[model samples]
Target: MARTTDGNPERLAYNDRVDRLRRKEYRMLKGTTYLDHAGTTLPATSLVTQFSHSLQTLLLANPHSASASAPNTSHRIVEETRLKVLKLFNASPEHFDIVFVANATAGIKLVLEAFSGHDEGFDYYYHRNAHTSLVGVREHAASSHCFASDAEVEQWLQDEHSFSGDANTDRPTLFAYPAQSNMNGRRLPLSWPAALRSTSQRLRTYSLLDVAALVSTSPLDLSDHAAAPDFTVMSFYKMFGFPNLGALIVRKSAAHVFDQRRYFGGGTTEMITCIGTQWVAKKEKRLTDRLEDGTGATHSILALHCAIDVHDMLYGGFSEISKHTGWLAKTLYERLASLKHANGRPVCQIYKDPAATYGDALTQGATVTFNISSSDGAWISSWKVGQLASSKNIHIRTGSLCNPAGMACALGLSSSDVQRAYASGFRCGQEADIREGIPFGMVRASFGAMSTLEDVSIFAKFVQDHFVGKGLLNVDDNDEKRVKSEEMRRSEQSSTPSFEKPGLRLRPVRQQFWAKFGACIPFRSRRPDVVSAH
Candidate 1:
């Protein structure tokens, strides 16, 4: 782990070192491709070991009271970890404060409950492609609206600026959106937050950016408060690959809205007493202290510090991670898009932003969602593909993936179509629904910092051999060969150098990747009858 003259580590010299660490540090990599990084990542060995050792040796007392020595020490650790979280986002202590929550869902709920006025009407706008947690915030707002596309959002913003009404202009408006879509891996425009404020000074505007997906493969900068979201939420595990904790980051400029909260909790109360027939209460003046109720996840918060250290060591920070995973995703996307049947029809139907590219970290991440089809243009069951993937130890995700609106919109399914399918006994996890030829789900393959070109190649070859070549006129002999252990070892070694190489191009990796594991295809039978409708 030494550095060269220019302060950059010589990647080639440490190739053997990384190889040894890969085998020992990441236990989850053994016998698995682990393409479900969007859902959750395998915890690092160092993180787990250090956390366990600390728990065994240290006295981690509750930070609720200051009457004892243990509690004081716990309080110190909690405060220090809070600063680290803020530093990770490039946020300053003067303008930003962090509140620990159960997860990203809890963070969103805290904002909606604290900001939304029940008596005074306010408009809540969010993208239709948002996660279920973001969509659920509509219930707390006075009025809710969903924008189908980015153009629709732009038109609504323009209309808000043109309207000439004193009453409507005075009411507050909150616009929440995802930095990247968990369903399709499409990155949205970051300039929308500033645009909302520029629409009108009369409109009390605020932005809530959901960075759950964006933080998994990229960074979210809050150094420039003018361009950053007024409130941002993300889960710590999404960034560190361990601990199930989340935080809500609030800008001091917009912290006043939290004063509207009606209730107080244990640590949030500064003074509470009853006088005669009435009760008097005073809340903590700090924004985080006022919002965080009950006791925080003390151990998880401490582990977050270690997770950050391990994250920095493994990927060298978000910029390096973005470059590494983006190339892997782009390579996977292009290869999957290029697969064709004997009749020259595309075998995969991918959903993504048209403007996104592999080199553009702002537009895309290491996630790909698509469906496989046969030569006669018949769709294959995504559930079936997922089951096949499990047999090959290739982990992936299927179904709507917790974003119903985005899933339905991506497949071009109408409201009536969804209702009809629902009435016919088709549910989210029902395997029989796939046989009915209903567009119920899609297959997703997500990459991360630990992902290599071999993982991408195996997934591509799986689709080509089992789904595409299974229904073709001619099949290669390699399609019938069983993947031997020695060949797998060769594939692993040939693709190992890319892990330490920064700014690695996709073409060279693909060339060397396919050279070793490209011919290793899944088993296929003779011409099988196509399942067209189902």
Candidate 2:
């Protein structure tokens, strides 16, 4: 990888190199157009090969072993991987502790469980645009609220006393928001967490930054730990495309709070008695030792370690990948936003923040979510778009994308309307695509390090050929059938030449995100983590 220069030719050359990398490491993507990076990045060939090689060579045992003779190889890999992760975010080990988990949702659950141990029950304030996982935390809070607008959050930041009454001053407060909207690829204010932490609030406040979306394409700089969020959660698979791992990056200053969590598992305990005495001791010496419940995912952790190296080698870190994907997204956005039916009606409804998300490198990542409209001005179901996409060998995400608040806000659907949806039997993953002429979901295509301009073009063409002016008349293809190999792809291409036109112009509509709160939530109280008397 050569130094990135501010020249078009260099960028083109870099993109060519990426194409070559795709040819070598991502042959699995040969016959298909993969646009579902948000669901999971396509695993690279070298990642699997290297991971297998490492497993064959290393004798990694469980991190905790009763036998003194067994080596702590697993522990070593976990710690090294932690340090590498810290460095990835410009965080210092001294300032932050990494706790590996199954995935991002698992990390959020860990935080909620830890916060539940507070003596005075924690107060949870979330932005309305948070993911469904973040929404679950309110179930454990003493009180919960959703901030519907930035004005509401600004008001809270300016006057924390406005939120916390004198009677509830001692309760710990957890403010959670996603760094980017998983639903619409809307990059939110990275400045909010720092703002929340520095506020003059009577309650003990902590910020939970969900970077599961942001870290996939952009860098999260924690160089100034004090200015960073208190707890950051992410899935390693989002960035590395392998190992299906996640981490909770806890500010070391806030490390004591998690120690209070009441639950303790096998490896988390230093000592415990089940037969004779009612006593237990937790391994509180190190952060990882205290939090990871069972035997750690040793093999996955090794793959995670390899993934870090592989990503750097393949894409030259997230900075370069950011620019690469951003350009593609912007190009796609412009084209999609320009699409129109023959009757002069717009063909797509794109949900985004035009000022903040599009081309604002600091505020946006590479994701686009939109819904198509028929030539007759009727809304097309995202489910139809998704089905057509699959039949055309284009992989995309459809539906609400697990952001209920964002979906409600985007569609202007009230609580009663949501209830009506349920009344109409609109269950998750069901064919409740549209009801009463209202759409329930939008199509989403996220770009990754390996995603090229061709992927975006193919998706745009798919939308144009099947949608635009033609309604459901072109549904003759084998639904969900794939051209598995290059030979099959060539045979299909030679047999049926695509008459698909290439164009996309998603209707530009601004939307705010990364905040979800309710007026008054009757939150529950859970047992707090055990506090140390020493």
**Model 1 per-residue lDDT tens digits across residues 141-238:** 66666676777678876776432223254567788999988987888998988777775562587899999988998887888887778889998777
lDDT of 2: 0.75
Candidate 2 per-residue lDDT over residues 1-534, each given as its tens digit = 112223567556767888888999999899899887877887789889999999898888766674653347777787898899999999998899899999999999999988899888888888877888999898889888777766677898888765554326678888899998898787778787778777566237888989999999888899998789889999988887888999999998888778779999867887898897888998878887889898888889899999998888777789888888887777677667778778776676777654355667776678887777777766777766765666567888887788887777766566666676777656443344677877777788899889876776777777776777776334444442442232245545564432222331121122222233343221111100111000
Q: Model 1 scores what on Cα lDDT? A: 0.71
TM-score top scorer: 2
Q: List, in order, the clash count of every candidate structure.
A: 1, 26
| TM match of model 2 to true structure | 0.87
